[model samples]
Target: MTYSGAVTVGGPAEVHELADLMISKAAVGPMNNNAYLLRCRTTDEQLLIDAANEPRTLLALIGDDGIKSVVTTHRHGDHWQALAEVVEATGATTYAGRHDAEGIPVPTDVLVDDGDTIKVGRVELTVRHLVGHTPGSIALIYDDPHGHPHVFTGDCLFPGGPGRTTRPEHFESLMSGLEAKVFVLPDETWIYPGHGNDTTLGAERPHLGEWHERGW
Candidate 1:
């Protein structure tokens, strides 16, 4: 079956395999948060994005192989509801955006910022800091050597528009960041969001102007 990137809580995860990496996406928690498990095909080392909720489900997906690290995209409570437990269970190193690290209950082992590289076995993901939804919200970019780039956008982006922001300034900041950082990628770049279904840059690129105009 094809990987549609649409997952439901308590349902099986959707898997997308690339040249050097395999991505498993699952929806967990009442909020329907999306958690992604990325395993390096060559080295077999794994990195999990967002220990959102349901440690048992996340752990089951991880199996006995245990992952190397857990990255919380932002400081949102819903995004890290299961952080402590998942980290406790796996003893995985914790990483979060530098500014929002203090907001998360678990002590972040590594404070990541824009341009930082996170390694999952031999695969390196480039971190792009996107502000607005949270002061330190981040997105991870994996430039597959044999394929188009794939981005795991936390709450910073979605299928139709950017993440929610409280202030006009925040909305502008997010839009600017999206235009400067994310939109620059090729249209084929696959975007796996923090929740719900996945979308590509090409599908959402034309709506950037409309999203900014709508101020959402």
Candidate 2:
């Protein structure tokens, strides 16, 4: 189930310039969240990222192969609102950070925390907690032994922005999360952001200081 060949993202090809372009930007609200299907290009087993507003999109992506699990990044309506329906439709096990576990509309079979590992096919995502946007903002990184790391950054990092921090106390938490959890990783990780365009760990490294100075 290792996705060896090129994993073509099914979305706008203009992403080479933008930071991320996987999720449909136009589909927002009750229909706007970005849910991803992490499938082995060579197998039927798959892991679902955040469920979109249209739970049917999550449903349509399924086949006899079956959805193994549904992992939510946080409690934002945009991230997990359709989760209840997805769970009902697929019987998929759910995973979320402990802080936001209660917010998951579906029953969570497993509760994850920072440094946790969840595998789908050959992809083993090491979950990290970056909780400024919410109480349990989480990020997942697919660590390929030799290939580039693929980071599932819910709302933590953006093409030209990072997750927002509205309060002074939360600012340190955000910075610490970025510095300890995100910045500590190799510079080659490919960022798959929750909102807009995609970027790389290298591309975003320079803006850390500015983001901190701006104060959330």
Candidate 3:
């Protein structure tokens, strides 16, 4: 399957080839939340991100791949609507940001913290705790051996601006995390968000100043 192709019943809506790993994406539910399945080519181990919605659809995408773990980006309802069902079906270990773990439906087996490394087969993903979108919002970074970083930025960072924040303090937290953990990375970094299309750090970096001015 070609990269960036949609993964549906017949195929993946979006497919990304990263070194030894492949990422498949599908948008589900009324919220149009993006659910991602990451597979390790060498080990055949799979890690699923945000079981969003539609248990049947997710299970179909997962097929017999055998999900090793399910990682929830945040406690948002839209992001984990099918978590309980997915876990029951797959018996996969559940992980969530330590601060938001309590809020998610299924009890998180592991509470991830910033700077922690999440193992997917032999691959290692660095975790970054991004606040504002949610106190426990977190993003995972995978440095592909081929170059370019692949980051899954839950609801914290998106294409046009940061995730929705109701207060100035929340916005500040989001901006600070972006500046420190996200924007500081190379422009080639590929971003996979919770919903909609994919974007690169290079494509969004130039507009950071504009985003700040708009106060979104």
Candidate 4:
């Protein structure tokens, strides 16, 4: 088991440690992609970043109260196909940018826009609406209250790259959002993307020009 792949982040907190539960990438079907399960240390609350090609694997990581909420970065099937199954079992609310509805098709209980905030137990997540890749794509900023800030980039950003914008219009919009949103964060922010090894906002900001040129 691995923290960034198939490993589980488990253990009750001790005197010096807080419960930082996590379930990194499990098998993602034919795509072999990675998904994330980021658990809140203080609250034992879990927030899923993407559904991927997994259902049972996600269930195992999700545990009892189920996941606190499932945040989809964009509408690609690789990121959200397991959603219905998860919702059927966990009853977690789905939150996504309004523009990516076509991919989910299912109704989103929470429709978020830029600057909207979602409270999950002790954590508060702010929405950064990023268009392109698929209009309404977004990244979630988790304010830990006491610990370091975290960002769930979904498909918008990755360890070595940003997401792809299939449409020219989406490409343009995505670049704009990248400059104004994702790149503006502090360096310490842990970027939990839909796939791959996690990186920091500081590590990615310098590559803005290349990402923009790629049309994503």
Candidate 5:
């Protein structure tokens, strides 16, 4: 089946296969958080993005292969509800944004910043810090040599608009970051968000101005 990127709590995950990577996306927790498991095809090395919730479900998806690292996109409780448990079970190194590391109860083995590179086998992901939804919200980018770029945006972005922000300044900051960093990519870039369905930059690029005007 084609990957639609739509998932529900308790539902089976959707898998998207690339030339060198296999991505499995599962929705967990009452908040319906999306957790992504990325595995390298060449080396079988794996990395997980957002432990989210439902430790059993996450572990089941992980199976016995285990992961090398678990990256928390932000400090939000919903995003890392199962962080400690998952890390304990898998013994994976924990990574989180530098500014928000202190907010997470679990110790961060690696404090990542914008432009940092994280490796899963031979595949490398560039970290993009998008502030607004959280002080240290980040998105991971995988530039496929044979295809379009893929981005795992935490709560920083969604299909309809940017993630929720409490203040006008925050909204502006998020908009600026998206334009300067994310939107600059080609329109074919696929966006896998922290929640809900996926979208392409082309589909959302037209609405950037509208999102800013609405101030969400």
Candidate 6:
């Protein structure tokens, strides 16, 4: 089941830019996981998020740019299929939610919690520990200087609604976390999910009540 639009070399076509930070994304692997390469325009330091799969493809995206860190958004297997390889090749520090640290294949160098800040060159990404998608699902929020706040929502939040959950309690937890932390932000916030196209807080805002009522 090969997915189309697999980006290999000089790929990850530019997705968006925030201040001096440039975001590039590539759809890779059978699962079509989105691997993002975030580069700091000022210092050239980069941070690759999700290292999801296709090590060779991800390596091409990294190119000669030095990666300062690789952050796994959650404990899901699909999200870290190439983590070990990427880490070995780049020697970048690995970060994950402390609770989900044991689930990832690679050793986590840094355990981040809510409110923690991760530095990519001069930019700082605030960590939001959103649970439900996984016990320790987290999202990284970057306040774009030229635009709205950009959030990397691993699988917690999506375009239509919150991520998939089996139990009602998990759904409630996810909704509450988003309400308290994410939904309160400006409506212009751009949402980059774990897979597929991106959305905005404003775009999904109107459906919050619908999601709650539907019990998804």
Q: Of the candidates shown, which would achieve the greatest lDDT relative to the real structure? A: 1
- Candidates sorted by TM-score, best first: 1, 5, 3, 6, 2, 4
lDDT of 3 by residue, 80-183 (tens): 88999999989999989999998897999999999998888988899999989899999999988878889999998888989999888899889999999988
Clashing pairs in 4: 1-7, 2-7, 5-25
In the range 1-216, model 6's lDDT, one tens digit per residue, is: 222323443344545655689888787767878888898888889999999988998898899876989999999999999999999999999999988999997999999999999999888899999888899989999987777798999989877999999999999999999999999889988888888778889989999999999998
Against the true structure, candidate 6 reaches a TM-score of 0.93
Looking at model 1, the pairs that clash are none
Candidate order by lDDT, decreasing, is: 1, 5, 3, 6, 2, 4
Off by over 4 Å in 1: none
Score every model by TM-score: 0.99, 0.83, 0.95, 0.81, 0.99, 0.93
Write down the worst ten-residue block by lDDT for model 5: 207-216
lDDT of 4 by residue, 1-216 (tens): 123322222322112122443334444655655566666566777777677656877787677757878877788877777888988888888888877866686578888899998766666779999877777788888655556667777777777676776677777777778778866667877776666557877887777777667654
lDDT of 5 by residue, 1-216 (tens): 899999889999999999999999999979999999999999999999999999999999999999999999999999999998999999999999998899999999999999999999999999999888889989999999989999999998899999999999999999999998899999999999999899999999999888977889
lDDT value for model 6: 0.88
How far residue 100's Cα lies from its native spot in candidate 2, in Å, is: 0.8
- The Cα RMSD of model 4 versus the native structure comes to 4.4
| Residue 215 alpha-carbon offset, candidate 1, angstroms | 0.8
Q: How close is candidate 4 to the true structure, as a TM-score?
A: 0.81
Error of 5 at 51 (Å): 0.4
Root-mean-square deviation (CA) per prediction: 0.6, 5.5, 1.7, 4.4, 0.6, 3.8
Tens digits of per-residue lDDT for model 2, 1-216: 322122223432221221221211222344334456776544446788887566655576654666889889987767877788888888889998899888767777889998999887655789999878788988988766656677888887876667776887787787788789887878887787776556788988888888778776
CA lDDT of every candidate:
0.95, 0.70, 0.88, 0.69, 0.94, 0.88
- Cα deviation of 180 in candidate 5 (Å)? 0.7
Score candidate 4 by lDDT. Answer: 0.69
Per-model clash counts, in order, read 0, 8, 9, 3, 0, 0
Which pairs of residues have clashing backbones in candidate 6?
Answer: none
lDDT of the structure predicted as candidate 2: 0.70
